[model samples]
Target chain A: MVNWQLYLLMFLPLAFVIVFNYVPMYGLLMAFQNFDPILGIWHSQWVGFQNFQQWFHNYQFWPLIKNTIALQLFGLVVGFPVPIILAIMLHEVANDKIRRFMQTVLYAPYFISTVVIVGMLFIFVDPQTGLVNHLIVSLGGKPIFFMASPRWFRPLYVFSGVWQGAGFGTILYLAALTGVSPDLLDAALIDGASRMRRIWHISLPTIRPIVIIMLIWSIGDIMAVGPDKAYLMQTPLNLSASQIIPTYVYETGLLNAQYSFGAVVGLFNSVINSVLLIIVNFIAKRLTETSIF
Target chain B: MEWIRKLPKRSTKGDMVFDIVNLGLLLIVCLIVLYPLYFVLIASFSDPTQVNLGHVWLWTRHFTLEGYKVLFATGSIWRGFVNSLLYCALSVAISVPLTIMAAYPLSRKDFVGRHVITVILTVTLLFSGGLIPTYMLVRSLGMVNTIWALILPGAVGAWNIIVARTFFQTSIPNELLEAAKMDGCSDIRFLIQIVIPLSKPMIAVMTLWVVVGQWNSYFPAMIYLNNTSLYPLQLVLYQILVQNQSSIGITSSPESMAAQQHLAELIQYTAIIVSTIPLLVLYPFLQKYFVKGVTVGSLKG
Candidate 1:
């Protein structure tokens, strides 16, 4: 017999998803309509692909795509492996007390607000007056404008992200690593395998599935370069380097009130992210025999 | 013979060297993580001129609580802090119970629509309507610029639901639930009496995750909140950190030049430190739970 209580309990979460997530997808038609509040979606004029073209032809359009893709690629290239290495290192830590302490400290930055992290960066990189510059000058080196310089922005963003996030990211792999049989490790040890060899030959292969799943998930979120961190960092000083698709969308839609154009740009970004995720998932499934699906 | 030859002597010099190098690298990683936080704390106490000159690092050269004095002087900062606390508390209260209930049914393999429910939730994690649609929905609900916009829109994240459900399925045995059912315990009764008691670690972990997510959150506050008064601590602190010069409101002062200069260097760093401290204080108590929660959540279903 079907339980009525189950239905009652499920109501709130189900209702919330439908109301908030599914319903607003109707708003995506705002990209097509000259979406007026008074007329609403059904009555608004269908300009079709005009809004999408507006984003495509904008002077800054290619740069936005370039910046967004480059940053995502940079994050994946530099950041994708650190957590795996960290998980391995953490797994090797003989003492639970120090391992736990290190994990706690490593994750401290992840809990810090993004704005705060960027702020800490600003302090760290202050040219003549920054701590980094002071250290450089004290040791006889030139001060550099780390935030203002275009070249440094991506590295700073990606590295700081790794430092902040790698620990938290390792949690999953470590969990998977725990499922590896101790007997297997003992066998490897008896065969004269060093810790590094055991990790490479045994520990790694076991956790490979979890790693691929996470990588796929991360790639799916690639286009979602957070607007807050990028936006907050984009002073006139760093504007050229920091300008990306999300910020462009925000400026076009919210700041300049080009709602249609902004929606089109955002929709385009989402489409690109979705396509990349699918492609990567296909590749991963082919290569590793693992998929998010 | 090959295995015996391949085996290195225990506690060899090469192994000791590798261990030392590894330990050193780990220490450096810890220092890199820790120093930014330490520097900010010290700089907030140090003289602004000294801080600007990069004199403050490990300790404040001129220790004063002046930055805190100035930070707390503004009524707006305190108001934002309270709003943030209220928002986090309310969201946790709503989210924790909702998640438990939603997760409980899904955890049961015998639940009629378990796979369907799981697929429905997981799909959202992989794809969403993106920001604009979500915002439009919030606006349509008349929740824009309200605390409800913050809480109700994100009551149940798909990732968290999966995590909670995984915790339940793995940790809570079906035998226990069946026994409870045999004793004539209803679903709600079993949830309250059996599931909750056994699920304390997961609950603690989930609460910590949700609470941290809420507290450190700035983006939703930035978008949904039109009223400056409704702005959370992170948003206000973000404003301070972003527009380093503008935050001080330094007009018509006898010491205008010095105050302006001091305000620039100290405020950003100080604001960051202030924003981070509250959550860090709560971390040690919750760290074990967080690790456990993350571990459980990350395991593939």
Candidate 2:
């Protein structure tokens, strides 16, 4: 018999998702309207495509797109392979104690919150007395103002992400790697294969599907580059390098109280993510015979 | 000599080289990962003057708790600590159970509507109304600046529900569930009595995730809450670190301005450490659970 009690159990969570998640989708009509907060969504004049037109025609649109894509690509390029390499090296460790110790040490930073990590960055890269600046000065160079400079923003953001996240990223890949049969490794060794050769042939192939899956997900996630850290790091000085789509919406909609225009920009971001996800999944299906949906 | 000889021997010179190089790389990475935290630890305790001079390194120079004393002396920090605890506790209490309930049905093999529900839910991951609409909805409910605004909107995460569902499906097997069903148990009873006990490890992982997530989150607070009394520790941290609210160490004398400035820097380090203490203490015990969670969760796609 089908259990109605299970339906009863799922009731609140389903209600939560419908209210918090799906109802918001229905409210996306504000993106099409000239929304006045006091006038509210229903009473707001529905000026078809006017909000989108404003956002698309805005001078900030292309730069926001470029910055978003550039930052994600930079992160993908640097941050993606680090955990894979780390896991491989970890997988290679003959000594279990050292392997576990390295894993424990590496994963610790992942526990540190983003705000704290950024705080650490502020303290460590302080132009006058920061650790980075101290070394720079000791080496007979000028102590660079890291947080103030626009040119350094993406590098600082992406690399700090790697530092914070790479260790934890290894867990998934490492889990996948554990599925490689010991018999295959034994066979490779018996064939007088070098350790590198075995890793390249056996280990690499075993993990390729997961790698492809992660790459596709990262590509799809380009538009959803969270505004939190970027918002925190933005200075009037670095707005050129730092203003991404999320922050732009937050500034326009929330901060400047341009709710409709903000929704238009934010809706653009969501659509781009959806499109990229579908496109990437299509490419993945064709190229790798792997797809999430 | 015996211990040295007991070490795992490599079959080839190439393997030996790889081991040595691997160990070296791991050591450098460990140092790189660890040094910033170590510096913060020492710097919090070191003399503010020495710290400002960039002389504080591996150990505290003229150790003192002045930074912490100054940090804790503020009324806001204590208020933030208690508020954060409340938010974190409420959030986990609500979210973990919601996640489990959603997961239980989705995990069922014979639940005909589960696929439709899942596909509907998964679409939210790819695209949605985005920020303004969500904020507007929260506002519509008169939830702005309320604790419920923080707790309710984020209480049920679809992705985590999927992860927990997968854990239930794979780990707790259909056969086990069928056996329970045959024993004259109602679905609610089966859940509370049987499934809940069996899912302890997953629940523990889910609890840790929800708690850490709630503790770390401030963006929601920034958007929703205007009241200072409602400020969580992370929001307080945003003030200290990003806003650089060095007003806490503002000068009593212009003559001691430099001293005040240095103490301000020291206080920043202390504030980061203080805000992070719950996490740092709980992390070691919980690290294994994260690995397990990630491993299990990533099995979704």
Candidate 3:
């Protein structure tokens, strides 16, 4: 039976996805043509692969790609696992009151606006008199130019990401943790297994599927970092290190009016990200018997 | 709470020791996460020089309200604040209903095309057009610099839609629908008259998720809004704390210009407090519903 309710339900979200998500995809052609407002998309000069070639041959192309992948990989290395570790730690804690309180404090940062997170970074790291520098000096170490230094940018960005995200990310893993049968934990304990062994042998294996699903999702997002936080952090001193693909796109396309070039770069990024996601999903399914699809 | 009530409470000596040690470590982690926020609050009220000197810790030193005074003195800041709230409100209004209608049917195992729709939504979750194409579409739609541009483009988050779908699928039993059908209810009627009333908690959680998303989003506003009037509060704060870099503030210290290169740093911290306060004020009351509702919705799925 074609449930009338089902058809109505399907049409609404589907209509939304079509109008908003899929329709925008047609705009990708602007990257190929010399898009002009008067000429319109259909009538614009189709420049073939010129836009992609321009992006490829640009002096800063490789550097931007390098920075984007580096920062994302750095984020993945630090950001992905902190939540899992935190969730395990949180699950083991018997005190509900304290655990809840800790959760609230940690999750609180996630709610703070990104502009504010970037802002707080400046407040805490002024090399002259910033709180972080003051502490370092007091501890008999030289103050670091955190925001300005190329060396420190990735670490600062990644650790701050962990601080904001680890708490909220715990909710997913914690949800998966709830599925770990208490009977298994008890049985392991009855067999004189240590707490660490019980966690390693039983709890870890049970939550493995959820972790794999989330890992696939994270790998898919590797190229999609927005330009805001990194752009905000950019100064003459740190532009070399801080500039990434998104910032480059914004500067070249929107700010400089190199619209075709920007679109080409964006399309390139999308292709790479999609390829990465598919490859990661294939490897995950092969290795772990789990996949996002 | 149900799970806690069911848990066995008796503990061994090692368990007691481990619990104490674990509590201490967790407390320290909590403090490490929260202290920077605490310092920002204190420094926002403190005199600029003392703040710059790093003299204040745990409490305000040479306290003043200059940052707030400067922040409020700008007519632009107030406009941005109102715009942010407007964006959040309109987004919630559109998103909540569409999500409810969409999620409820997908939750039904008998629904044709459910799996297909699920795959389509899941694809969007993993891969997108990467911003520029999306922006071009918005511009093409003539939504740029308009408030609807912000509200409409992101109305249905695929992840949230799926989550809501899972919530409905897991929470609402088919037997209940059968009972409602036996009582001679139509599809929309059963949805309006029974399902919505039963789905209050999931609705509330999704509301929080959507509202928080719209409220904190500044990048889209920066991209789509050329009009300063359309700029959200976070974007205005971004300009203040970032673009100027404290070099041109009215409060520039001749006595401390070299040392005060970081003057805008205070405003950045102050901005965090400003941007976060509205959501934080509402969070405690919603916290119970958020976890309880999401857990129930997710656990069953």
Model 2 residue B277 lDDT score? 70
Write candidate 2's Cα lDDT for B1-301 as tens digits. 2311133333676766766777788889999998888888889999977986878887899999988988878777778889989998999989999998999999887776998889877887777888999999999999998999989998998889988998888877677778987887788888888888988888889999888888888899899999989998888888888777755645578768867776777788898888877787897787777788887787564
In angstroms, the error of model 1 at B119 is 3.3
lDDT of 1 by residue, B102-220 (tens): 88888877679878887788666556666766776687678898889889888887777788888888888889977978888888788888889999998888888788888888888
TM-score of each: 0.92, 0.96, 0.90
lDDT string for model 1 (A34-121, tens) is 7665576678788988887777788888888888889888999899999898888777765677777887887777788787888777
Docking class of 2: medium
Instruction: List model 3 lDDT by residue over A211-278, tens digit each.
Output: 87677768777986888788878877887779998888887877787777788888788788778888
CA-lDDT, candidates in order:
0.78, 0.85, 0.78
TM-score of chain B of each: 0.91, 0.92, 0.85
Give TM-score values for chain A, per-prediction.
Answer: 0.91, 0.95, 0.91
Pairs clashing within candidate 3: none
Candidate 3 per-residue C-alpha lDDT over B1-301 given as tens digits, one digit per residue, 9 for 90 to 100:
3322223444345655555666677778788888888888898888767877778987998777767765665667778789888888888899998887788788887787788888888778556665666777788789999988888888876767777777777778889989988898777788888888988888888888888888887788888888987888878888876674432344545756653444455555566677789897788678777876555544433
Give i-RMS (Å) per prediction.
4.4, 1.9, 3.6
Model 1: how far is B3 from its true place, Å? 30
Best by DockQ: 2
